[model samples]
Target: MKVTITSIELKGPFKFFALSYRAMHILRQLKATNCLAMKKRGYWIKHYTMTLWKSEQDLKKFAMSGAHLAAMKASKSLAKEIRTITYEADSLPDWPTAEIMLKKAHVIHY
Candidate 1:
């Protein structure tokens, strides 16, 4: 499976609800796709998500279109920082392991 982890730190407390609204849209879209599993955790001003897919191509396909694409574009302003990591995995790991991988993920600047 292709496992991807993403984390976001908001610029202000006010932005969390905005991000949550967008997240809801994306999560709704996710159900119609080929994604295997999805999970999320939040702490303070940060939010994290983990997703499982059949391949990186499948993941990219979802990202490059529709509500997700719009949310990603909007997130640049709503987030103080955003980071993501992608790798192969035989099975989904527990949230603790996923959080560690997210912590080690490279930062992305938009």
Candidate 2:
């Protein structure tokens, strides 16, 4: 399946909690056939999230959807600035079985 690795660096003094909530709302509206956490790392108390998708089209559709669009419009008003790197992957490999994936990833276990 296709995948998109979005690395977002949030600007300081931003409403991180609210923006995070909005991001989840946008992800929830995505029509992707499947989604999974890829890799995640954080520095300086900021947050980083990696999510896999069925295809670029599916992800782009969500980016253009209302919730995301509204968030984008507020980028300037944000307490933190944001930067995103979107990579369009041709194929993704090494997805473990559901049980294994669930058991291994702390956040996904629930």
| Per-candidate TM-score against the hidden true structure | 0.91, 0.52
Q: Which residue pairs show backbone clashes in model 1? A: none
lDDT of 2 by residue, 1-110 (tens): 44443333455524566667766766665534345445544444244445566677766666776786887676555434333444545444243322233333333100
Per-residue lDDT of model 1, residues 1-110, tens digit only: 89888989998888988998998899889999999988888877889888899988899999999889998889888888899998999677787887788778988765
Top TM-score hit: 1
Off by over 4 Å in 2: 7-14, 31-45, 88-110
Q: Please count the clashing residue pairs in each candidate, in the order shown.
A: 0, 5
Model 1 clashes, total count: 0
Q: For residue 68, what is the lDDT in candidate 2?
A: 68
Cα lDDT computed for each candidate against the true fold: 0.87, 0.50
